[model samples]
Structure formats: structure tokens, C-alpha cells
Target: MGVNISKGFLLVLVGLFAYLSLLLVLPFSQYVLGAILIAYVLYPLQQRLEERVAPPIAAFALVGLAVAGFVVPLVVIVAAIASDARRLLEQVNTDSIQLGELERAIEEQTGQTVDLPSALADAAQNVGTMVLESSTEWFSAITHTLIGLGLAIFLLYYLLKDGSDLLTWMRELTPLPDDVQDDFYQELDEVMWAVLAGHVMIAIIQGTLAGLGLLATGVPNAAFWTAIMIILSLIPLIGSFMVWGPAVIYLFLIEEPLLAVALFVYSMIVVGLSDDYLRPILVDRYAELNPAVIILGVLGGVYAFGVMGLFYGPVVLGALIAVLDVMNDHYDRLADEPGMR
Candidate 1:
């Protein structure tokens, strides 16, 4: 008994040491986590491609296509934006045409002086500073992009090449029974699929609708605004609102009441439907998680992990809930056994 106790104590110590070591290596851990997620997202496509060809080459080509699909457009957009950004900034700063109608309309509406010249000066100064700061940041980003991309590509390639074997090895390492392991993986898969399907679909729909609305209403920089809306739409609750609110206010200030109303109506219909209705439906269909669990997971994940937390947070929460559910099932079964009480 004493020897057994000593061995158990040593095991506990080793586990604690490993946990602390992981904490110490969290930056690398985050990258690994990100790679795992990317691999998981792309695995189905890889498998489909493998069905048609050799596994190794299929994996490489699939990852390459995925990388190109993401990187090429991103590079092109960034390059174009970088090239045009300075000219745009100069235009914004140098152009000083007064919005006489806007000022008069604002004064009429609010009984305020509406100091147009002072505001324009302030706006130009802000714009100029923003332009300078953004250019510097973009240059820094460009320097880092190659290094990051190389690392992501390497990790993705290895993950795609050996992911199945790695998963099998991990499954073997788990001390849990096979049933428990299966349950955990099942829950994890459901959560990931739900998040991927719900978030991506909703973002695309919202972005498309926003772009269409902007184009229909003759808004300048519609594509930029639409892109911004799509990115913002990843956040829960107040995503698209952030993009459309200022736009509507600007339209109102410019006395484009009809355009403002149309934009508002269209945004309400499309954005609202996608986020409020469609997303939840997909999540529910896939995850079967309690609403409270979903909300807490999202809020907690965001609080702890920033943007990526949205994907990882709910998954962790779902796994926890799944574990508890399994425990409850066993407990209830044991309680129902004859003479158990």
C-alpha cells in the first residue's frame, strides 16, 4: 500500500510538471493549436482528394491549393491597397471642399453651428496621421508575413501528411476507455463543424448583402466597407452593427434619407437573418449544446483567447459538458441497478 501510494504521488507530480511546462510553452502551443484547427478544417477536402489519387501528393496539392486560395487574393488585395493607400490619403488630406448642404442640414436639424471648416481640418489631420501609422504598420506586417507563412505551410504540410496516424497515436495515449475517447472526439468534431459552417456561411452572406446594398445605394468604397463588415461579423452580437451604424448616420447627415432607410432595411433583413437565425440553427443542428453553454463558451473564449477563442472556446465548453453528460449517464445507470440504494 505504501509503495502504491508513492507511485501515485510520483504520477501526480509528473502530471503537474507537464502541465506547468505546457503553460510555459504557450506561445508555441497556440501555433500548434492553430495548425491543428487548420488541418481539421481541411482534412475532409484532403480525404476527398486522396480518394482520387495518392495520399501524400493529394495532401500536398490540397494544402497548396488551400494556401493559394487564401494567400493569393490576400496578397493581391494588400498590394493594391498599399499602392493606392498613399494617393487616397493625399486626396483625403488635400481636398477641402465644404459640405455646405450637409452643414446647413445638420444646423437645421440640431440647431447647432456645425463648424464645417474646423471639423474638416480635424478630420484631415486625423486621416493624415492614420495614413502614416497604417503605412508603417503595413510595412512591418509585410516583413513578418513570409516568416509566418513559411511556418504555417510547414506545419500544415506535416499535419496533412500524418494527421491520421497522429490522431491514432493520441487515442492510444489517452488513459480513458475507448468509449470515453470516442465520445470526446465525437463532441469535438460536432463543435468544430458547427463553428466552421455557421461562422463562415454567415460571414459570406452578410458580406454579400452588405456589398449589394452599398452598390445599390451608390456608396463610395463599397467593397472596402463590405470587407470590413464581413470581418467584423465574426464577433457575436454586435458585429455588423458596428459597420452599418456609422454608415447610416453619415447618410442621414448628408440628407440621403432614402438611401439611409434602404440601407438600414436591407441590413436589418440580411444581416439579422444570417446572424440571429441561420447561425444559431446551424450551431444547434451540429452541436446540440445548451444555449447557455454556447453563450458562456463564446464570452469566456473571447475573454481568454481573443478572436480565435470564438472557435476554441465553445469547443472546450462542449467537451466539458459532454464529459459531464457521460458521467451523469453512468451515474444514473448505476443508481438504477438492483439493491444499489
Candidate 2:
């Protein structure tokens, strides 16, 4: 009875501390996960670099490379987005948005008048006002953003340098058999590649195609919008339509009916449907994940983890699938091994 009480007390302490620990790290969870994902992807290059240099040097060099390749481009794109956003706000506030054709069509068909320009102008005002009002919060977030970035870089450096050792330590801690662990690792690696290669490649293709339509329609800053489309395409349900859809409307508002129709058709048939056909061929080759899994992941992940959930959601599902696969195979073999029940 005394031993049972002692054990219960110890369990309570463990659970209490575990919950506290989680609370401590919860705010920075995304940054931590992002560093892990980036490290996983770059580990191969780190290995190659280590062939000619020390681990620390290799890691430092790769981190610099990552900063240049990933961080620099993102910073440039963000600045461009801000510039474009300001210009767009000015245009929206000043320009007479043409909706006469649509208004006439609506009145002719439905026998009702619609004040699209007034409604749009009101919406733009609300959006601009909200942004201005929230500027203080945005400024405050910069400090947090810098901290997260610094943490990610610091963690990434060590992850690259001692990642193998860390993995070995983790492997030792797990009670699973070697073969089962191996299977789990293999599945995870494949899923990582699937997310990076299959999903990202599709985004790039859709974005590029959408950009071509924008350029053909003579939209200003087509390249900037294209880059935005590429990023938006990473989200499953929304895809690249967020950008090109607006472009279609913009063309119509500018009274380019033929170009608007052409863009709408091209984006719908080409940019939109490309993933419907290509996903099975590409993602299946690597992860064999169902489309539904990814869809659910995106929905749930976004609700739970914000923007980073886009990457996390699919990976969580993939890990679950891997666990299930390993469990099934391992137990099936064990059951088949013959026994005195």
C-alpha cells in the first residue's frame, strides 16, 4: 500500500512537470518545428559538406546558405508585397472602378441594381483602416518574429552539427525493435520529400502558369504576384486562385472582357486542374498519401497552428500513417511466427 501511494505521487509529479514544460515551449513551437523540418531537408547537404570540413564549419556554412537562399528571398518578396499593397491601396482609393457592364447585365437579367464600386470602395476602406489600426500590433510582432528567427537559426546550427548524434540518442531511447524503427524512419523521410518536392513543385507550376496569364493580361508587377501565388498555392483548398481570381476581376473592372474571359478559362482549366491530375502521379510515387489526408491536415493544422500548420498538418498525418503501417506489419509477422498460445 505504501509503495502504491509512492508510485502514484511520483506519477502526479511527472505529469505536473510535463504540462508545465509544454506551456513553456508552446509559444515557440512553430519555430522549433520549422527548424527541425529545415534541418531534415538540409541534412544531406550537411553530410556532403562535412566530407571536406569540420561539422561546425559545415553547419555554419549551410546556415549562411539557407539565410541567403530562403531568408533573403522572403525578405525581398515581403518588401515588394508592401510596396505593391500601398500602390494598390492608392489605386483603389482613387480610381473609378468600372462595373457598368456588370451592373447592366445584372439589371437586364435579374432586374436589380448593384452598386459594386461603392461596395468595393467601402470594403477597401475597411481593410485599409483595419491595417492602419493594427499597425501597432504588427510593429510589436516584429520583436517576437526576430526572436523566433534567431532561435530557429541557433537550433538549426546545432541540429546540423550534432543531428546524427541526437538521432542516435533518440533511437536508443525508443523501445521499438530496430526493423520497426527503420521502417518508421524511412516513411518519415519519404513524407518529407513528398511535402517538399511534390507539393512545392505543383505550387511552382501553378504559380508560373498563373503568372503567364497575368503577364499576358498586362498586369503590373506580374512577377511579384506570381511569387505570392506560388506561396498561396501551398495551401490545399485555396491554391493559386486567390491571386489569379482577383486578376480576373481586375481585368473585367478595367473593361478587358476578352482578356478576363481568357484568363478565367486558362486558370480554371490549366492552373486549377493541374493538381487534380498531377498529385496522384507525383505524391503517390513518394508518400502514397491520400488527397483526403492532406486536405484534412491543412484544415485542422491551420486551425491549430496558424500558417506553419500548412506544413505540419500533412506531416502529422503522414507520421500517423507510418506508425499504423509499422504496427500492422510488425504484429502480422509476430502473429505468423507460430506459437504456443
Candidate 3:
């Protein structure tokens, strides 16, 4: 009893230290997890390269190539998009682009005056105040984001080279039987690729399609909204509709009925159907889960894990379900044992 008590006390102290250690890493946990996901996907390529080149050299080369090829281009695109969005916002704030035309058209149809310009002025003022209040917060956020990106890239290099050893350690540490642990890891791999690559590619495709449609239909700042739509498309069922839906309504209000009609049809048939047809193909069997799981996972993930939470949430939930199934199997085995009865 005394030994048991001592052991319990030791465990409690260890747990306390462990939790504190986790808190230290929490600020950058998203990057660590993101690195894991990217490294896993790139591991195959890394392995292929390792056969000819040295392992460390191959991993370093892969990371460098990815940063040069993928990350650099992405940053450039994002900066360009941000500049376009800023220009649009400036136009809106300065009244260079007036909603008054749309407002007058609405009032004409409904026979009720809507003073949208005044409201926009008020909105702009409120936004200005909000920006002033949040500037420091935004600075901190930007700093953290840059740090996270750097950490992710650095970690990816090592994970690509040494992840197999890590996997071995994880298996040994896991409490479950070897087979159950293997199964869980397999599921994790499959679901992760499905969630990340499947969702990201689909979102980019749909967002680009939506953006092109918007540009073709004469929507201002199509690039700005396109970036937003790509992020929103990570959500199941919502996809590009969030942008295109508002766009159609805006087009109608501006008295471009033909443009509105075209936008609506294109959104429904092209953007909407693309997700329906392609998601299952991309996600394979992982896409067959209840809709609520996806919604909750995504919402919870964003709240918990920032952007990467989008993939992390659904995958975590899937893992929990896998654990539950394993426990249920253990219970079933116990029930089958006559000695326990």
C-alpha cells in the first residue's frame, strides 16, 4: 500500500510537469502537428531519394526544394492577394466604389429608401476603431504565424529523415496491443492524407473556379474573395457557395440580372458539384462519416488549433472513434471468456 501510494504521488508530480511541458509547446503545437502531416505525405518521396543519396542529405534537399518551390510561391501569391484585398478595402472605405447604385436599385424595386452609404461610413468608422484596438493583437498573431511556419519547415526536415524511429517509439509507448496500435496508425495515415491533400486540392480548385467565374461576371476584387472562398471551402457542404452566394445577391442588387443568373448556375453546377463528385474520390471511405462530425470537427478544430485545426479536428475525432472500437473489442473478448463469468 505504501509503495502504491508513493508510485501514485510520483505519477501525479510527473503528470504535472508533463502538462506544463505541453503548455510550453502549445503556442507552437499547430506547427508541430502540421509538420507531422506534411512530413508523412512527403516521406515516400524522401524514402525514394534516400536510396541514391545520403538520408540526411536527401531530407535536407527535400525540405529546401519544398521551401524554394512551394512555400516561396505560396507566400508571393498570398502577398499579392493581400495587396489586392487592401486595394479593394481602400476603395470601399474611400467611397471610390459606391454601393449607392445597388442601394438605389433596391429602393427602386421595393419603394423604400436605404441609405447604404451612411451605413457604410459608420461601418468603416467602426472597423477603424476595431483595427486600432486590435493592432497589437494582430502583430502578435503575425509574429506567431511566422514563427509557426519556420518551426513547421524545420521540423519537417527531421521528421522526413527520422520519422520511422519516432513511429517505433510511439508504438512501444502506446498501451494498446501491437495489432491495434498498427491499425490505429494506419487509419491515421489514410485519414490525414484524405483530410489534408483531398480538402486542400479541392478547395483550391473550387476557389479558383469561383474566382474566375466572379472575374468573368465583373465582380470587383475577385482575387480577394477567391482567397477567402478557398479557406471556406474546407467546410463540408459550404465550399465556394459562401462567396458565390453573396456575389449573386450583390449582382442582383446592382441590376446585373444576367450576370447574377450566370453566377448562380455556375456556382451550383460547377463549384457545388465538384465537391460532391471529387470529395469521395479523394477522401475514399473517410468521407462517409456523419455530417455532424465534419461540422463539429472543423468548427472545434479552428477554435482549438487555428487553421490546421481544420484537418486536425476530423482526424482526432476519427482517432477517438478508433480507440472506442478497440475498447469495445476488448470488452467483447472479455465477455467471451467463460472464466470471467
- Indicate which candidate wins on lDDT: 2
Estimate the TM-score of every prediction.
0.72, 0.76, 0.76
lDDT to native, each model: 0.74, 0.85, 0.81
Between which residue pairs do clashes occur in model 1? none
Candidate that beats the other on lDDT, 1 or 3, i.e. the better one: 3
RMSD (Å) per prediction: 7.5, 7.5, 6.9
Residue 192 miss distance in model 2 (angstroms): 2.2
Clashing pairs in 3: none
| Candidate 1 worst ten-residue window by lDDT | 332-341
Could you give candidate 3's per-residue lDDT for residues 221-337 as a string of tens digits?
Answer: 777788889988878777778889999999999999999999999988988788778877776755344557767888899998888888888778867776676667565664565
- The model with the greater TM-score, 1 or 3, is 3
Instruction: Tell me the spans in candidate 1 whose CA falls farther than 4 Å from its real position.
Output: 1-25, 28-30, 76-87, 90-145, 275-284, 289-295, 331-341
Candidate 2 has a TM-score of: 0.76
